[model samples]
Target: MTIFASYSIKGGVGKTALAVNLAYALREDGHRTLLIDLDPQCAAAYYFRIKPAAKFKFKEGPKLAGRLRRNIRESDYPGLDVLPSNMAYRNFDIMLDRLKKSRKQLRSILAPLAEEYDSVVLDCPPNLTLLSENIFRVADHLLVPVIPTPLSERTLEQLYQFFKEKKLPPNRIRPFFSMAQKSNRLHREFMAQLRLDYPVFLDTVIPHSVHIERMGQRRRPALDYAPGLAATQAYRKLCLEILKG
Candidate 1:
């Protein structure tokens, strides 16, 4: 299975949107996609219209981990398998610390599904922590959503440093642009700079649009709700680029 994680060290740069749309695009291609919602905000679930039942809540104290510990069955998510999260997930750090185990809990949890699904797309919270570490440990390809800006570009530097300090390999990371404004000169400049400098960055760019923003409010991926739209087509191309690698 190709385990692709969509994450960004910096928030508010459209990471979740790109992840959601790309997962939808993969599902449309007849691939059995497994999307794990790792963010404490639980936004991915909302986007998929998956309601949180009482069983989805934290059965144990101080942890927001999913209760479905088995290999994610097809029925876990009616359309596509989703390991949903709850608001209490913000407490997972302390809970993980209390266990005093390797921070690779997320990897061990997802290991069983490696045999079941074709692609495992994890929507991680935007930052480095125990959860991020475990996600990286298990990820085959890391999908970073970078905007066209200096600060966003700088976050890429910090991500490399974080791994360097921790003695982790950096080759698995793959970056792409989300909400790109092609009309802007700076966007063009950053794209050229990063593409020349970072060979791992993908080619397909997800352009900025009102349709993409409103997609979240409508509670569905733009590709699913409007596949004929320009944004959807761009996302599909991005999926092809991902599969190419």
Candidate 2:
């Protein structure tokens, strides 16, 4: 499976929203997709109206695959399945730390799932940890959401620096503007600067819209609940851009 992680060092940058909609968009494009909620907040699962994953011990290879397979919950949408997160995931750092080659352990655990899925979307938690490092090692692409602002820009720089220090390929990280407001001068300026600095910035930008916030209330992808909305259209464009890459 091609693994795509929606990640950021800072929270509330629309990471989960991107994961949810992008997974749906992938499914809409006819790819068999699985969205794994790695975030302790479990917002992606909640968005898909999926139940929480049962607490289980983390094991290796086939054993670990069995545990994950048992928890797979089919979504209301066709071609999309969800592996919900539970509070047990908060202990991931402790679990991974005990394993050898911890930074690459997550890739091994997810390897077997490739046979069953065409794409895997991860909704990751904020902050850096061994688990985060494993995610960085495993994900085929890192979709980072940047809210056009000074603090968000600084966080993006920190992420790039971390990648440089770790010797991770910078091209693997794709940053895009989220919750952007064209009316705001600061937002426009920061976005322009970001584009000039990072030519890899995605062409599609997600706007700040109440409709997106309603995904929580509606418990569905925006494309499903608020069809033809600008936010939904933007997400579709982003999904296509991701696929093309």
Candidate 3:
């Protein structure tokens, strides 16, 4: 299975929204997808109308996998499932610290799911913590949402530098413009500059839209409620780019 993580060192860049919508898109393409809400906020799960899962004590590998399995909830969309996050997820870094191969433990935990899922999309918390390192080690692709701005550019540079310093595979980082405003000259210029500098940036851009902002109120992916809209079409295009990758 391919593991795709929607992550960014900076929050409010549409990471969770990308994860939720991308997972739905993957399901629509006939892939059995599992969306795991790793953020303590559990916004991805909330989007799916799923409640926070009960937290459990971590044990051996089998037990841990069992716990994760029990927490998986079928979504309204066929071929898609959600493993909702809970407050206990805040302790994930601490729990990983206790493992022998802490930076790689998440990979082992997720390995068993390959037989059941064609794709696993993670809605990761925004931070450069130990847990973030673990995610970097495990995820096959890091889908980063970079807002077109100076600060966002610097943060993306920092992430690339971190990868170089830590000897992680930098090529795994696939960034794309999120909340892009074509009407804004700065946004357009910054996007052009970034694309020139970083050829790995996906061609698809997600536009800033009221429909996307209303996801909290709608409690579902834009494709579900606002299909045929530009924002929803952009998500589909992004998903196609990922699949092509």
TM-score of each: 0.88, 0.96, 0.97
**For candidate 1, what is the TM-score?**
0.88
lDDT of 1 by residue, 141-222 (tens): 8889889788877899888888898888898888888888989998999889988878788878889988888876888888
TM-score head-to-head 1 vs 3, winner: 3
User: What TM-score would you give candidate 2 relative to the actual structure?
Assistant: 0.96
Q: After superposition, how far is residue 168 of candidate 2 from its true place, in Å?
A: 0.8
Q: Write the per-residue lDDT of candidate 2 for residues 151-215, one digit (tens) a residue.
A: 98789899899999999888899999999999999999999998998889999999999999899
**Model 2 shows how many backbone clashes?**
0
Show where candidate 3 strays beyond 4 Å.
58-62
Candidate 1 segments exceeding 4 Å error: 53-79
Better of 1 and 3 by lDDT: 3
In candidate 3, how many clashes are counted?
0
User: Comparing candidate 1 with candidate 2, which one achieves the higher lDDT?
Assistant: 2
Best by lDDT: 3
